[model samples]
Target chain A: MKLGPSRFLGRRRPREYAGGGRKAAVQLYHVSKSYTAGHYALRDVSLEFGRGEFVFLTGPSGAGKTSLLKLIFAAERPSEGQIVVLGRNAPRLGPAATPPLRRRIGVVFQDFKLLPRRTVEENVALALEVVGAPRRDNRAKVFAILKQLGLQHRRFHHPLSLSGGEQQRVAIARALVNEPEILLADEPTGNLDPELTVEIMDLIAQTSTRGTTVIVATHDYGIVNRYAKRCVRLEGGRVVEDAPAHGATP
Target chain B: MSRAAAQLASFLRAALRGITASPLTSGIAIATIGVTLVLLGAFALLVANMERMLDDVGDALHVTAFLEEGLAPEAQRELASKAATVEGVASVRIVSKDEALARFRGGVGRGAALLEGLSENPLPASLEIGLADGYRSASGLARVSGSLDGLPGISDLTSGQDWVEGYLRAIALVRGIGWGLAVILALATLLIVANTIRLAVLSRRDELEILALVGASRAYVGTPFLLEGLIQGAAGGVLALLLLYAVFRLVLPGFEFGLELVLGGVAPRFFTASEAALLLAAGSGLGLFGAAAALASESRP
Candidate 1:
């Protein structure tokens, strides 16, 4: 049956599944990433994340949480694994293939990696611009996203002029501007107050309601306890637990 | 908009943004290029004028052969005829000794009475022979002298060999100096262009890196800088042309009368349209290559 324009068109496609129901958004089978011969960031890790899943990656500073996020974003390749992101094998795809994959995934770095010279509006507009959106549409979409993030008033101000919380909001606005199907945040609230931390986590949880899968990597246990979503706990490069926060133990 | 037009617009906007970000540095670069181009233009004019002057001097000279004192008019005529038949000789004119004395008296009219004490005309009849352009060299004149030395009535075969050799050597030296100056100045021009481009690129490195991160092709990042280089070069070339014109105009009037007496007209020291066009093309090419080299060298992983 012809069902209008495919929802997956220009959106993230589902990852391939052996038994398909709601196919996994991200699937890593026996994945291992090693920078050098004796050092492996992730070792034989097998995991699957279904569509619209909200998961927390908790681990100590050097426990491979960041590495796992990097792999998902196609920033780094696995030495031995099948990393399928939105149905495309990460290792098989070359440099040219990464941009399109990246366009569908939103990334909020821990350092709020915003261009200091650009205004808040411009920072958010970059995401839309990268995806080849029309100029007029990009302007309107960026403004709307900024207004939603409570940063419309500071649109003309550069990131350096903004407070930490405001800068974090701008970063979030930039990541979510393109309405990416997958949102990846690394230490999104590591520098925020308890109230601000809950607010950021609530915003992430709300985004998953709109069918956007959110994966946040952090060392903050307080946030994971409060949000109480599916937690993928890692210790020393191995997944110690992959289960729902308040569900039956597995 | 068409695809190329859209791309061009994007590049233009980006270049404009870059220039706005650092106007002082760009201005300095443009001025440096202008000065270099002006020097090169002046050198070109000097070479052109020197070549023209040499050509004029070579064309005006000839060989003059004096006849023996006891030679008859018939013998002188036969000798003139034989000299004209020489392979390198273009034309021969025979002047009798009496005619020579009369010409000398006319030249020094007030001193004519001083010459009356002479028993006879001291001047000897001479045959002046014009040499072809290819035979105007010292070696060629030597061949002509060998052919005419044994002819009847010909006592002395004197050509302007010394003067010709001196002029040839002077021209060769000047040409060598001009070439050396051109080479040194061209290298200076290249260095100036390269440094200017490097500064411009350094100022825009952040923008370039951002473009790369966004998946903009390398060509997209590089085309505007190349265009900027071409614009600077063309502007510099025109500035050089104007500066040369001004200098020539200031100096030309003072030399007009003296030059007219020497060359029969005022000599111009400016490039013709075709030559100016060549200078402009060369300047633009140099600028483009300099920018390309800077880009290639600075683009690292």
Candidate 2:
């Protein structure tokens, strides 16, 4: 894979060099996350995702897909072992360092997580606002992404007023507004009809062509088969299958 | 124009939106701060007037040194010149025994006939020592009185030091009570404001989660809430200022007699513009800190 710009965030990030020109965008080394004394959300899962790679996390209902995404974003620390994201150790990124790291990655949820009270444009602008982007630039960037998602006309409308597809599109607009290097979508199309599901999935897939590592966690085998991308199947918190994409990914 | 300004504008917009979304709770917080400031302002106004009257009285304060019996007029005049040399003594007037008697007689009104029974002048001759303008407070009076007390021909000395001390004590007591009340009310107001902002935080938990996912730092996510509290507090300050001014103008007349008792006919004055601004700032501080306390108590992403 051709190297994109290294946006490993601030100077304090550990293993920032991560030794020259490595292509791995994320690497998990026997990572385990547990919430209870005898139970594990993810148990000894090790995975490596290269830059610009598109992968699907396929699993049953409680198969630790969300946990993996959370760990990748530094939202959760591993109970054991190491997870590196964007050249920084995921578990060691302190509270101050996490946001800038997360800034380089975008995560979309099943519920579309748009602020209901804010207009669609404002919801998307949140990403840029956090980074103190100038208002004009924030507005132009937000408009460009909203236009890309084909929801520019709904910019002033609140989330509650939009259909689920449009709402999900707004969420995607927010996630992509900053042009993140990594895109994680946990069931991006979970609430949509099959038609909207493909529409959303195609939009998410288009991001990988721009050299963003894409990870979509979903239980629907139909989506897994349709995309035929590099697939990492998880069962009982462990990777059961790692299949290469049937077609070109990057 | 700049990114920091843009962020500030964003925070302000969010704060206004939060206020508009829950006008009732916001209004309650503002009203709480306004009421607290109103009582505090009232005490402040009263103390200000009393202190002003005290200051006005400072100009006329004097130390009187009574002459010993049989002191000649020349000796009395010499004592007056000597007292004039003391520090903080602006001037001295020697009132002879006959003048003192006459003044006493004239001051007794219709009862002057009773004083006529005394064949001789009974009042002591004294040098009335006027204090320098700057030397009128309790401490200043003490300094001048101390110097005049041991004069060669002077048997006794008296001044308004006791009265000045009493007035200062009264002012201190009022100021102490006002500050104590301010502290208690401010605490209550802060808690109420905190709870109000806490509810706002709880209501917007989803928005916060989204922001967090988008790489917003905790400060980024918490700023709007803090701004909301600050806005609420500042508005409350404005409310209290208006209320206090209205009362000063419209309602203070009914307490004319009370004002006379404290100010001695001196016109009451409202808080000056700078003082008013200070009150507003205090309100804003309370709101900002209240929001901070609330945010600190909250568990955020």
Best by lDDT: 2
Per-residue lDDT of candidate 1, residues A153-228 (tens digit)? 9999999999888888888898888788889999998888878888777877888889888899988877777777
True interface contacts reproduced by each model, as a fraction?
A: 0.09, 0.89
Off by over 4 Å in 2: A1-22, A245-250, B299-301
lDDT of 2 at B88: 93
In angstroms, the error of model 1 at A133 is: 6.7
Candidate 2 lDDT at B299 equals 62
Query: DockQ (Cα-based) per candidate?
Result: 0.19, 0.75
Q: Tell me the deviation in Å of residue B135 in model 2.
A: 2.7
**Cα-based lDDT for every prediction:** 0.75, 0.87
lDDT of 2 by residue, A123-204 (tens): 9998988888877788899989999999999999999999999999998999999999999999999999999999999999
The DockQ score of candidate 2 comes to 0.75
